[model samples]
Target: MIQGPCFQILLLLGVVAVAAADRRPSFSYSAPRASSEESGPAQYNFNWAVNDDSSENDFGHQETRDNDNTKGSYSVQLPDGRLQTVTYYVDGDSGYIADVKYVGEARYPDSDEVRSYTPPRRQYN
Candidate 1:
């Protein structure tokens, strides 16, 4: 039987041999390069809106982009009976800029019309 240092060396060699015998494949990834002719600024335009009187949901957004410049606007109906609109734009490195406007005056219910809330009691298990 192998003894002392020889036994330890043999055990280490066996472990190394088993590890080296593994044939699992290795993997790598690289992004595809864009062709020189295809290199150009991105441009697109899109708009969508949703208005439902039953659920009282009204909001929309539209944007147009040419190269590095972008322009867009979005509007929504406020619960206070006001139409809130925001117009914005972005030009190249210049950050986003916006202008907000409201179409109607806000209104609130009188003190007598407002109601107080009550919490229900919880039972212990």
Candidate 2:
């Protein structure tokens, strides 16, 4: 059997050989170029709305985009009974522009009405 310094040298060389064998070679890759059809201008139009009377959720949004230009509008029913609407647009390199408008006057409950409120009772399971 091998002994002392010779045995240690052989073991270290064996370990180095195993480590070198486990190493993988590095690789390089280049992404493929996009074709003409895939690079074409973008165009889309979409609109959605939500009106839930029970939960008092009333809001909607609509937008149209062609190439670098886009136009849209969105509105929501405020808690104070006003309809808040915003119309906006973006043209090419120009920044976003918007106009806001409200349909109805805001109203708040009187002090007596707020004081008459009562919390609902909780039931044990």
Best prediction by TM-score:
2
Clashes of each: 0, 0
lDDT per residue (tens digit) for residues 49-110 in model 2: 99977556789999999999999999999978899999999999899999999999998989
Clashing pairs in 1: none
User: RMSD to native for every prediction?
Assistant: 7.7, 5.6
lDDT of 1 by residue, 14-111 (tens): 99999988867899898987777855688999999989775567899999999989999999999777889999999998999999999989988667
Q: Which stretches of candidate 1 lie over 4 Å from their true place?
A: 2-39, 111-125
- CA lDDT of 110 in candidate 2? 90
- Per-residue lDDT, model 1, residue 49, is 96
TM-score of every model? 0.64, 0.69
Model 2's TM-score against the true structure: 0.69
Error of 2 at 124 (Å): 22
